[model samples]
Target chain A: MILQLIDIGYLVAVVLFILGIKLMSHPESARKGNSIALAGMILAIVVSFFTPGLNNIALILTAIALGTVGGLYSAKTVQMTAMPQLVSFFNGMGGAAAALIGLVEYGDLPVDDIGKGSVLMASLVIGSVSFSGSLVAMGKLQGVIKDIRVNKILAFLVLGLAIALAVYVLLSGQPKPLLVYGLVALALIYGLLFVYPIGGADMPVVISLLNSLTGVTAATTGLLYDNKVMLMGGILVGSAGLLLTLLMAKAMNRSVSNILFTSFGTAAGPAGSGQDGD
Target chain B: MDAIINYISVNQQEFYIFILAVFVGIEVISKVPTVLHTPLMSGSNALSGVVIVGSIIVLGKTDPANYLALTLGFLAVLLATLNVVGGFAVTNRMLEMFKKKPGKK
Candidate 1:
């Protein structure tokens, strides 16, 4: 009966998420949408406490408290001009959480469960990439890291290495902790290199893509555990991210891949033309 | 191959739900005007905080002996918390400014 209640809670949360996104498309209802989504999140978290197998109540509460304070402080203090960087930073955090969960879960799985292993590897790879890549995006936006020229040959080489590592791990047929870690490391490096070349003009698109990647990672994690709420939340975020990325790209009159690969800021138009003046 | 197929078949309902979500997600955000893109991005960034749910689940289920899991779980909670709280607060700030603009008519 309790399980049934939790399921109902998840169902309501998913409905609210959909409604929230639907309402957010226009300025008139955006604020209400956010509130609705916030309520959904609170409901999901509260309902999760009732699930079977959860323990360490005090630690969980402490983590939530610390996170709440940190999130609230930064949100309240950050300037509007730095919104992009702040968004990237928060998105990176979400990615980091998903990647870490994938890493922690890797040790417990049985060998030969290729299905589960594949999902775990995907979450690990995508999450690590998003985490590292979003940090690079933040760095670029903050001007802390400059001269991010893309070396195509080098970028391709790193991409090659990442792919090779993923293939090697897949073929090995068992979860070797060393190779898993190596795959994660390589993906992180690839992410850094991937975002280094993309200019600031493309940040919105890049941020959206990273957001989607984080969502995909979360969804994969949800799949590993068969958690309905997590799965639904992840899917919603993923699709929303993709949609936003496309919309932002369209707003700038650029293709998604073009924005990603070409350093438009350095090569052509006046600085800040692509971005809105707030 | 058979294992993968069996997995999908077992989770058919979940996949169906995922497909339905994709449609709704794409459909809902189609009407957001360009001027609000930044605010929309920030708002959805806050929504990504939904990952906190996954982090909590992982931390709660992790064995106490596994220090690595414990540490990672703690960090995940910290980071996701930052994302959720910061993302929303910043979005609200931006939206307040947005409301004052003449464009709202």
Candidate 2:
């Protein structure tokens, strides 16, 4: 019966999450939205303690503290202009967390359930890349990296290496845990290399992409853990993230690839050049 | 006693932290000027993208009992997307409106 607390808490958390997002639709209600989300997270973490096999209260507390400090510092210190970048950073952290969780689970379960294995591996790779890509995008937005453009050769090299690594992993019958780890590292670096050259004005779109990646990572983690709720939650996040990214692109009248590759809005042309007669 | 202490600590600490974070978020929102309303709304609306993935999962689950949940999730994603896109369009129009000269027309 004690286990029921977790379910109830999860239900409450999901409700709050939904309400929070809804309230966030308007500027006036955004404050409440933030509160609702905070409450949901609290409920989730607390309920997790009651779950069997999750007795590591100290570890969980430490993680929460670390994340809280990071979030608080970002909230306080980040300039309004950098809010989009900060959002990307948060999305990256969420993806990385989910990816790491899946990786750990895969390590624990050495038996090769091919379906779970493939999904977890894909999630880890995509999540790692998303995290690094988000950081690179953030760096560009903050002017920490020099404004540059993606060359065709570099693009081809990144794509080629990523594909080659995936094929190598698939064909190799060995339990290449180390290889998977290496791919994660390489993917992160590739993301950094891939996103850094992109212009600052694309931060909003990049942020949305990272958000989608986080959702995918979460879903993958859920799969690895064989948790239905996690899978459902992750899918919710991932799809929403992708749709938002698409919507943002449309708002700017740019394609997703264009946002990634083309240097749009770096140097402002005449302020109202695109303006049409109303 | 130790368990009691742990429970108390978790509840007290988490509760306070949640309250503080909520206040901080609210303060941040209250400080923004009217000119930033559109951009801020659009930006936050983008956060609702989480709904899309959530709905897809529910819909894909193939459970008849969850039909309502799936439908609601999908609607939430749709509405959220519209809010983000429409917010941006309105902001852009407002910007252009400000840029025009009255006598020149």
Candidate 3:
């Protein structure tokens, strides 16, 4: 069947992704590697339109156009120095997409099928945190949010509140999209509080943490769709993010909390020195 | 007419755009000094943390349809993680070189 050709394209896309990562390991080949990966993504996306029973052509096309235009403009216009901010935004987009998918699936759930509430709720939690946390991370990198210390006890209190809200949502037996939205908003606000207290140098670790959050979101979405690919992909990403975050924390010679609570890389005081404020 | 539109859409516009974007990104990076390349690579490699998360979820899926998908996804994650680690190592090495004393005359 002609539909099988799309599988071949997918195969090529995967190959390109692997090759691109390999090429990117070195300076000379990094450009080619990135291009290869981009090509793979393009190919994969184009082939999606040909998938059998994909009826929402108009909606899908609009989303594609919007994502493409936004991505292209941001990639082209953003400065090299602002790469961290751009990375944060990209990670946020991934999380937001996953969250949207999860929320959609949540809405369509049958009344008798509230069995996997914990997994679904976990997805919501991680997705919300990633979306808002990435934004706050971006703000820290951009200096929009000043890097300063917050009361540790206060931070814990807020986190406790988030947990309490999450428990209530899970136990209430009511499907409240507004409540989910509220959780996301609360997470976003809390992200501001969390990342604001962190110094700038710790951005890489924060970014990686957010990356892991996005992965959890993706895996949850995968469960909702009964799609193995999404689940495996999410787990791989999440694990790698955790590993990278740990490595980065080790490199910085700081505990995760120390990185979070103190100004790590803020431009305000002897920025890039990395020797102080630890 | 519909067939023709479909053919052109597939054969002409999308591929051309893809090719153009890739080449342009290549060109922009080419113009920059090679030194920036290592750090940039390190940073981007770090960002590929997303790819790893994406792949692991695929691997963890219990569905049989994703066997090949899971295998390939794991491979991608492996390579990406290697790049992240290797790039960082290279960056740290580069930084250390800056700290070394010059040879005496």
**Which stretches of candidate 2 lie above 4 Å from their native place?**
A152-160, A163-173, A263-278, B1-105
lDDT of 3 at A38: 51
Off by over 4 Å in 1: A264-278
Give the CA lDDT, 0 to 100, for residue B32 in model 3: 30
Choose 1 or 2, whichever is better by DockQ.
1
* Cα lDDT tens digits for candidate 1, A1-278: 99999889988987887787777778888878878877887888888888789976788889889988888887778787888898899999988888888887888777577787778888888888999999989998888876477777787787678677766676677778887788889889888988987876677789889988887787888888887777777877888889889888877777787777666445555665434433
Error of 3 at A165 (Å): 3.4
**Residue-level lDDT tens digits of model 3 in A1-278:** 76578657655754564455445545555556556655654554455456554443443444345544555555556565776676676666665555544454455455234444555666666766776788888887888877666666776676667677766766676787777667666666666667667766678789877776675566566455443334433543455455556556766676676576555434357655444335
Q: For model 1, name the residue pairs that clash.
A: none
Where is model 3 more than 4 Å wrong at Cα? A1-19, A50-52, A111-115, A261-278, B1-105
Docking class of 3: incorrect
The TM-score obtained for chain B by all candidates, in the order given, is 0.92, 0.44, 0.47
Residue B86: error of model 1 in Å? 1.8
DockQ of each: 0.71, 0.03, 0.03
Candidate 2 Cα deviation (angstroms), residue A246: 2.2
* lDDT head-to-head 1 vs 2, winner: 1
The number of clashing residue pairs in each candidate reads 0, 9, 30
Poorest lDDT segment (10 consecutive residues) of candidate 1 chain B: B96-105
Q: i-RMS, every candidate?
A: 1.3, 15.8, 15.3
Q: In candidate 2, what are the lDDT values of residues B2-92, reduced to their tens digit? A: 4335534644533343344333333334444433333433333333223222222322332344444333333322332232223223333
TM for every model, in the order presented, reads: 0.93, 0.66, 0.64
Candidate No. with top DockQ: 1
